[model samples]
Target chain A: MAIHHLESVFFREKVAEALEDQTLRGALQNATGLFRQRRLAATASLSDWEKLRDQARAIKAETLTHLDHYLPEFVAKAESNGIKVHWARDHQEACQVISQLVSEKQARRIVKSKSMTTEEIGLNHVLETDGAEPIETDLGEWIIQLAGETPSHIIVPAIHKTKAQIADLFVDQLSIEPTQDAEELTKAARRILRHHFAQADMGISGVNFAIAETGSILILENEGNARMSTSLPKVHLAVMGLEKILPRLADLEVFLRLLPRSGTGQHLTSYQSILSGPKRNPDQEGPEELHLLILDNGRSAILAEEITRQSLACIRCGACLNACPVYQQIGGHAYGSVYPGPIGAIITPQLAGLSETKNLPYASSLCGACRDVCPVKIDIPEILLHLRAKSVEAHENGKEAKGFRMWAWINRSRFRFVWAHRLARLGGRIFMKNGQPPQWLQRRAPVLGAWAKHRQVPTLAKRSFREIWKKELSRKQP
Target chain B: MTRNEEAKEAILQRVGQALNGGGVRAPRKHPITDQHYAGRPQTDLDLVSSFQEKLESVGGKVIRAQNLEQAFNELWSICQERGIRNLACSDAPSFRDLTDQAPEGLEILDFPHEQAELLEAEAGLSEAQLGIAETGTLVLDGEQENHRLTSLVPPVHIAFLSSKNIVLHLGEALSRAQQARSFPRTLTFITGPSRTADIELTLVVGVHGPRELVVFLLP
Candidate 1:
């Protein structure tokens, strides 16, 4: 099993590798293209999608502004309903709370649903290290876990794996006969997982929305694994980012409308579970104990800033990922983080800090497709620009920073701008081969060189546009 | 403070400081003003037919029973079609009446407290609180006679929904959900049979939950 850890340090090399894998590119293009089309069609039924987006954005913004108030309200309501709410300041603490809960139950086998929060905290690894076997119940999650890889997409984890490859994985792991049929592969997985579901002692899941009004956690899933995880297991733990809370149950109407459409282009997911607490009646079948972990892993830091705080409003629909051209080319693994798209680019650096993930912000072309398709209208490009500035400030007076400043100074005056253009053309000739800079120059120069390696560097015109305009004006006057 | 309490306090304090805490910013008045339905509002007749169409489109079977005899016939046929020999049912009145008339040789299991009976049954039955027409959703309130496993653990789930329980949209459902002083412990909105497309975006039905969901709508 490949160790699934952030390769942010080798972001460029990772992207280069992903670019060469035709299979990965084909799978991503096919999956993301379908998602983009479905979202358009699904949303076209609604005449007031923009208004709904505005309402969603406002509700999230207002709740975040009063998070201190809503968090306690949610805790109080949830606790009153027989749910034990735990707060974790960081990833380690979050893992400890869960580990304690698991040990307290003396649970040996654990089942988990698809949760980006669990992925962020590396929850499965922590549980396994503590002597509990955590089985991923979601089919996508199960396939990736079998292959010892993390999720490649937020909603569809194994989107990059071909059916043939999946069939092979099933044959190797579950000892099922190798078959090219997707349904057979799925049934083989189901046959094996159902046994674990019956024997599993605990289940862990992620919350899509935590409603403060009712103190309920909403989870949406197309597969019934999440339902099984919560239904069958005696102990269920819901790990949620503290920012997931909404002010009211009424707010869910808009989000519920937006989430399924933006995510998979479905009118609704197969199951939308709204759980408030553990079983109230002795006869009712649900977990005896419900534990809610509210995680604050550097999210408060992002919420402190006005511009970057809106990034916290993400619902994890993965719309931005599908809309991004750069993502279509490189795929999620290239971002080298648990999150691998535009949202990942902004939030990963914020959560992990800019020093290690600085290259992630520059991964985009700032084409604004992500922002345009964003259900909540999170100005993703604006956030990318903000992160770029932060990355620059962190490395103030560094070589690249100095070059940018120098370029900015020269472009401020007409003469320097024209002279710089002339020099650039001369440099172009000296470094050019077939109208593109050589890889060696890119290696030595490092800034433009790095970009030119992946993309074509624009050739300088023989005469400056400014000079040509001036000559034409003079000739017309004569 | 204990370790857990201390952690909770620290997180809340950080959130307070980040959002400028307590009386610093006045609470904004954000009203829930957009009452407009996103999709076209369906007429009363369209609600039933559209609900059936939408549910069927998502891989769920709808058996519209005009009366008690028709409903019983539908259940018998479902058992025969799926080769369901052992079945479990909720204590809902509709299901209880059907259990009395359940076919011979069809073993009827009770909702066991140990929950082992639910696992062995080929099919389980429950009565839905209501149905949402817009999304073709079944709203089940678990605090009632319905057990979560009755619809979940079995390979097949049969739900008995009444025609009058069908609503136009999610807003109506939310209002209905909010009617109680406190929310139910488990409130589920099930749209169709469990499915997945995780493997190369290939749609595969019956992943973990009920592979087949049959709804017998009572007139």
Candidate 2:
């Protein structure tokens, strides 16, 4: 994948690098702006949008609360529909199961849709290592694959690329004449990938909503690439997060309205496929075999936490990504994860654990724009704060802990408090150069200086308010 | 235990534990409410025009015919305009009248016997089970013989939809589907032709599936 996986601490460095690129900034602004406008317009048609959000939230919460029951029901229904179900506790296990299936089928060529689950497990890399070609058929995914990169946005994966850049990529990779027109470029990709779609022995897709009652998996896509990937191949495999299941088919009415409106502002995506199983007879010309892999991959850990489990309600609409002020500036690759933006900041830490992903929670401004747009009403900012507190608790013996200790000591009594104020005034006088703090303060005073990097330090008053109060009292008595 | 069985056990156990709050509470059930759409008809116009306007807005063509004769005429003219000679069609009775009157030199590859011909054919024709007015979507199930590939693989797809099958909203369609014995292995709610805005946000039609979708609404 072209998206580099760096430790979360490099978030700042990545943000800085992304901000420095003028072309990338323009592309991000244009793409996110269009998405934001369209989403606003799409939802503007409805009067009960908030009511719908609440209903969606309640439904997800209910389904997850009884997951132990609902999951088995889904499995049974899926099995009865001539579909095979596999369970994996982690990404490694998920990859292993898929690899076993590939080997069993002797599938040399595999075509795939834009599935974050596959990306989450690094499935393409695994397939390559296992000698099976995993070809991404989605246009955005295909471009990124050719460029050796991962998706930058959930809806528009290659949003960072301009038409000229895409043309250049096609010219280099597909040996086509360089053209900047988007339609011509798409035509070139279609001509090239059409053959691969027909030749692929197996197809892999990601599920948007798995209707447990009907034993059907819904895949939402504007491009028909996903439809092709599932239809042309002899065998079809769909991988889904365990939390993607819905309790009833009727719930799709709410989600089907919310998802497209929030994602790219389409009334409905060009194609919404509700595939229950593979081709059943000579009548249907779909895949002969169908397999669905329900992957847990640390989502159960999220479900285990009472406060943060609501994060699983996310429908991956990418609405929050467009609404996020921070995401609009830095784009998704800066987060260094398959999922990015507000949902990513909250869920990635829990899914991957806090040790390496602790810095992710700090990647937000807590503006609640994400919560406003989330179809399932995941309280993203609240979850971010929760994760931040958890991260701090794990770092109790660190610099912040010492700073809090000093703060406690100063507020113990009047004398110490006065002395602390005096010391602060003196430090400000010494540190202030040209009426501003020097750049070296960041290196010298680690905590305060780090805070000063993106903000202005509040100047200490010339005289303490306590001193002025005492003098005024003495004057009144006289 | 076998790995698959052990994995399932571990997952289900984790879920039970999570719902139980690590032994703090007991498993609880949450009530699910259905009939969410208020069960009111929102559209003022007749179902066919509403469905037609909605479908055409998304780049799909809706040919309105009062009877099967006019429907066949519209289809024949469409085939002439597209210059389609070999059209793959479904074996549904709704399209039987049109198939019988298929233009001269037009070879209809009727399924399930000719299902394999859809892949190589330029155009495919099938009868939709339902037409949704709210989104201009055609609902088709996989259980129907010659339904799947006839509408998917070909560059152009022509669907025959009856006026009676038109619904006011998706909720109506869902309720109908819910009452069914069981959903087929595959179903589709196609709104427009296969399109993508993936490349620099420019709309490109016909990425993988049929580039063109034409529907004939018969009264």
Q: Per-residue lDDT for B1-219 in model 2, tens only?
A: 878888888988888787777555434444444456422346685788888988999899888789877887887888888788878777777656455678887777766644346567888888888889888999986666457677877889988888899998877787787677767667788898989898889888987888899998887
Estimate how well candidate 1 is docked, as a DockQ score. 0.67
Candidate achieving the largest TM-score: 2
Model 2 CA deviation exceeding 4 Å by range: A1-6, A439-442, A472-478, B22-34, B38-45, B94-100, B112-119
Q: Give the number of the best model, judged by DockQ.
A: 1
State, as a TM-score between 0 and 1, how close model 2 is to the true structure: 0.95
User: In model 1, which runs have C-alpha deviations exceeding 4 angstroms?
Assistant: A1-4, A408-433, A436-448, A455-477, B21-26, B33-45, B97-100
Q: In candidate 2, how many Å is residue B138 off?
A: 0.5
lDDT (10s digit) by residue, model 1, range A307-344: 88898899999999999999999988889888889999
Q: Compose the digit string of candidate 2's lDDT tens values, residues A359-410.
A: 8999998999998889888889999999999999999998888889989988
Q: Least lDDT summed over 10 consecutive residues: which range in candidate 1 chain B?
A: B36-45
Clashing pairs in 2: A2-A148, A2-A149
Accuracy of chain B in candidate 1 (TM-score): 0.89
Error of 2 at B44 (Å): 4.9
